[model samples]
Target: MDVSQVLRMNGGDGDYSYSNNSLLQREVITMTKPIIEDSLTNLYCDMNFPKTLIMADLGCSSGPNTLLVASELVKSIDKIRLELGNSNEPIEIQIYLNDLPHNDFNTIFHSVPKFQKKLTKQMTSYSSSPRCYVSGVPGSFYTRLFLNRSIHFIYSSYSLMWLSKVPEMINTNKGNIYMSRTSPPSVIKAYHEQFQRDFMTFLKCRSEEMVRGGRMVLTLLGRQSDDPCSKECCYVWDLLALSLNDMVSKGLIEEEKVDSFNIPQYTPSSKEVSNEVEKEGSFMIDCLEVSQVNWDASTDHNPIFSKEDAQGYNMGKCMRAVAEPLVLSHFGESIIEGVFERYTNNIKMSMSKEKTKLINVTVSMTRNG
Candidate 1:
C-alpha cells in the first residue's frame, strides 16, 4: 500500500474528524508544552535575536492543536522580547505548517484567520508587534521541502513514529499488524533498518534546511526499553491484531489480508534515536525525556463515571481518528465501526487486568557544522 497516499487522520468536523478525536494529541501537546517553550526560548537566544525567524511544524495535522503550537510559539518569543524590552526591533516570524498532501489543509487554512486575529490581540500589549506569517506546506517531511539553510527552528509532535512505508519484507510477521513478542528477529531487524534509513534521511534533509545552531523539538510515541517488542510499545497493536483475527474467525475479514497488513509505524527507544543522531553527524542531541500516560486519562475531564466503555472507547476514538482512513482504504468502510468496537472491548478487558500506557519521547536537537 502507498501509505503516503492513504495515511491521514479522519478529516472534516464530523464525528471522527481529527479535530474532535485528537484529545490524546492535545494531552501530549500539553505534556510537552514546557519543553516546547524552553526550546523556543533557547533557540531565540542562540540565534542572537535574528531579524526573521523561520519555523516549521512537521506533520501538523489539522485541528486546534496545529494553531495552538503556533500560538504558544508566538507567545514564547513575545515573552522573550518583552523581557528584553526591545520596542523598536520586533522579529518577523514565518511559520510553515506541514503534513501529507492528503491532510485537511482547508480546515487548517480556515482556522488561520482566527489564529491571526487572536495573535494580533495578544500582541497589542507588547512593545512591538512581531509580523507573523502562517502558511500551509503540504508534503512529506521524510524528503526535502524547505529551501537550504532557511529555517531557524522546526518542531514536530505526535509524528515521526510513522515509517515512510511498511517494511519491505514483513512476511515473517504473518499474524501481527506490528512488532510483537511473537515477531521474529528478522522482523525486528527489518523495522530497525527502516527507521535508521528514514530517520537519517530526515536528519540530512533538516540539516540542509536549517542554519547552524538551528534547533528542533520532536515528540513521538516510543518504547522505553531496548527491546523493540516491549509491551508498552506494541501491546496496543497486539490488541488490534487480536481484533482483526477475531474478525477473520467470524468471516468479517480475510485472514490473508490481516496477515499481510502491517502498519507503517515504528516506536524507537531513546537510545535508538540518540544513536541515529550521532551517526547522522549533522545534529547534536541536547535532551531526551520519556514519559508515560495511562490509556484512560482522557476521562479525567468528565466527572460522572457512568460508563464502562469510557477509557477503552476514548483510546479507540483517538486511534480511529488516526488510523481510520488507512483502515477504510484497506478493508472498506463497512467494517470500520465493528473493528474498533471489538478493539475497544478488548481494551476494556485488558484494562481490568493491567494498566496500559503509551510512552512519549521528546528529543531536543541542535544543528552542528
Candidate 2:
C-alpha cells in the first residue's frame, strides 16, 4: 500500500474518531511542554527574536492536540517577548500545520476560527497586531514542504514511528503484524533499514528548510532496550496480532489474511535515534531522553469513566482511532469491531500480569550552521 496516499487517522468528531480519542497524544504533548517551551525560548532568543516567527508542526493530525500545541507555542513566544521587553513589538506569527493529504484537514480548518479567537484574547494585554496565522500543508513530511530557510521552529510528537511504506521483503513476518519475538532477524533488519532511510530523508529536507540556529523538538515512540523485539515496544503489536489470530480461529477472518497484514510502524531504540542524528549531520541533539507513559494514562485524566475495563477500552479505542483506517483497508470493515473487542480483552488480561508503558524518546535539536 502507498502509505502517503492511504494512511490517515479516523476522521470527524464521532466517538471513534481520532479527534476524540487523542487524549493520550494530548497528555504526551502536555508532558513535554516544558521541554518544547525551553527549546523554543532558546531558539527565539538566539535568532534575536524575529519580528515574524515562522514554525511548522509536521504530521499534525487533526485533534485538540493539534491546536493545543499551536497555543502552547504562541504562549512560549509571548513569554520571550515579555522577557526581552518587546511586549509592544507587534509580533506576527505564521504556523504551518502539516500532515498527509488524506488527513482530516477540514476539521482542523473548521476549528481554526475558535483557536485564533482564543489566541487573540490571550495577547490583547501586552501585544497588538500579534495575530497568528495557521495554514495546512498537505503532503508527506518525508519530502520538502516549505521554502529553503523559512521555518524557525519545528515540532512533531508521536508521529515519526510511521514508515513511508511497509518494508520490502517482509513476507517473512507471517502470522504477526509488526515486529514480534517470533519475527525473523531479517524482518527486523528490513524495518530498521526503512526507518533509517525515511528519518534521514526527513532530516535532509528539514535542514534545507530551516534557518541557521532554528530548533526542532521530536517525540517518537521508542524502545528502552537495544533489542528490536523488546516487550516494551513490541508487546502492543503482539497483542494486536493475537487479536487477529483469535479472529482467524473463530473463522471470521482467513488465516492467510492475518499472515499478510503487517503494520508499518517501528519503535526505535535511543541508540538508533541518536545514531541517525550523528549520521545525518544536520541537527545537533540538545536533549535526548526516554520516558515511559502507561497505556492507561488517559484514565487518570477522565474521572467520569471509572470501571473495571475503562483503561482497556480506552486504550483499545485510542488505537482504533489511529489504526482503523489501515485495518479497514486491509481486512475490510466487517471484522473491525470484533478485532478490537478481542484486543481490549487481551489488553486487560495482560495488564493484570504487569503494567506496561510506552517508551517515548523526546529529542530537542538545533540546526548546525
Candidate 3:
C-alpha cells in the first residue's frame, strides 16, 4: 500500500469518523497539556518572543484534537502576553494544520468559523485578542514543508508513530500485521532501522524550518520496555492478525495475502527516542514522558451493552477509522466489514482474559542553534 496516499482517518462526522471515535487520542492530548503549556511558556520567556508567532501542528488529522491544539496555543500565548504586560503588542498567530495530502482538510476548514467564534469569546480584556490565521498545509512531515527558520513552535499528537513506509525485504514476518513475538530478529531490526531513518529525516526537516530556541511537543504511540515486541505495543496488532488468520481458515482470504500484509507503524522506546534526538544534533530533549493509556478509555459502554463487548466494539471503530482505508486499499473493500467484525470479536475474547493498554510517549524539545 502507498502509505502516504492511502493512510488517513475516516473523514467527516460520520458514525465511524475519526472525529467521533478519537477519545483515546483526546486523552493523550489531555495528558500532555501541561507539557504543551510549559513549552509555550519557555518559547515566550526563554526565547525572544515573536510578535508574529509561527506555529505548525504536524500530522494534524481532521478531528476535534486538531483545533483543540490550536485553540489551546492561542490561549497560552494570550495568557503569557498578559503576564508579560505586552497585551497591546498585537500578536499575529499563524497556525498551519499539516497532514498528508489525502487528509480531510475540508472538514477542518468547515469548523474554523465556529472555532474562531469560541476563541474570540475566551480572550480576556487585558489582551488584544490576537489575530489568528489558520491554513492547511498538505504533505509529509518527513520532508521539508516550510522555509528555514519560519516556525516558532510545532505540536504533533499521536502521529509520528507511523513510519514513512513499511520496511523493505521483510519476507519473514508471515501472517502478522506488525512485529510479533514470533517475528525473527531480522524483522525487528528492519522495523527499528526504518523508524530510525524516518525519525532522523523528520528531525532534519523540522530543524531547518524552526528558528533557534523554537520548541516542539510531539505525542506518539510508543513503549516503556526495551523489548521491541512488548504486549503493550504489539497486542492490538496481534489480535487483528489473529482475526485475519481466522478469516483465512474460513477461506475468506488468501493465506499468502495475509503473509504479505504489514502495518507501516513502529512504537519507539523512550531511550530510542532520546537517542535519535541526540544523534540528529538539532534538538535538545527538555521533557520526555510515557503514559500508559487504557484501550477502553473511549468506549461508550452502558448497562445495556456488555462492558467487554462494548469496549471491543469502540476500539474496533477507532481502528477502523485509522486502518480501514489502508486495509481496503490492500484487501479490496469486500471484506472490510467482515474483517473488523472478526477483529471486534477477537478483542472481546481477549478482554475477557485481561485488559490491554498502549504506551504513549510525549516528548518536548528545543531547537539548538
- Candidate 1 lowest-lDDT run of ten: 298-307
Q: Indicate whether candidate 2 or candidate 3 has the larger lDDT.
A: 3
- Candidate 2 lDDT (Cα, whole model)? 0.88
Residues 183-207 of candidate 1 have per-residue lDDT tens digits of 7788888898999999999999999
**Poorest 10 consecutive residues of model 3 by lDDT?**
300-309
| lDDT of each residue in 1-369, candidate 3, tens digit only | 789999899999998899999988888888898999999999998766677899999999997989998999999899988898888778889999999999999999999999998998999852577889999999999999998999999999889999999887446688888999988788899999999999999999999999999999998899999999999999999988998899999999999898888899999998999999999999999999989888888787557678777887788888888888888888998898999999888887777788788899889999998
> What is the lDDT of every predicted structure here?
0.86, 0.88, 0.90
> On a 0 to 1 TM-score scale, where does candidate 1 land against the true structure?
0.96
Candidate 3 or 1, higher TM-score: 3
> On TM-score, who's better, 1 or 2?
2
lDDT of 3 at 82: 86
| TM-score against truth, every candidate | 0.96, 0.96, 0.97
* lDDT tens readout by residue for model 2, 1-369: 778876899899998899989877888898898899889889878988788989999999997889999998988888777887877788888999999999999999999999999887887464454668999999999999999999999999999999999998645688889888888888989999999999999999999999999999999999899998999999988998999998898999999898778888889988899999999999999999888898887553456655546787788888889989988899998898899889878987776667878899999999999
Clashes of 3: 0
What does candidate 3 score on TM? 0.97
Give the range of the ten consecutive residues with the poorest summed lDDT in model 2: 299-308
Candidate number achieving the greatest lDDT relative to the actual structure? 3
- In angstroms, the error of model 1 at 155 is 0.1
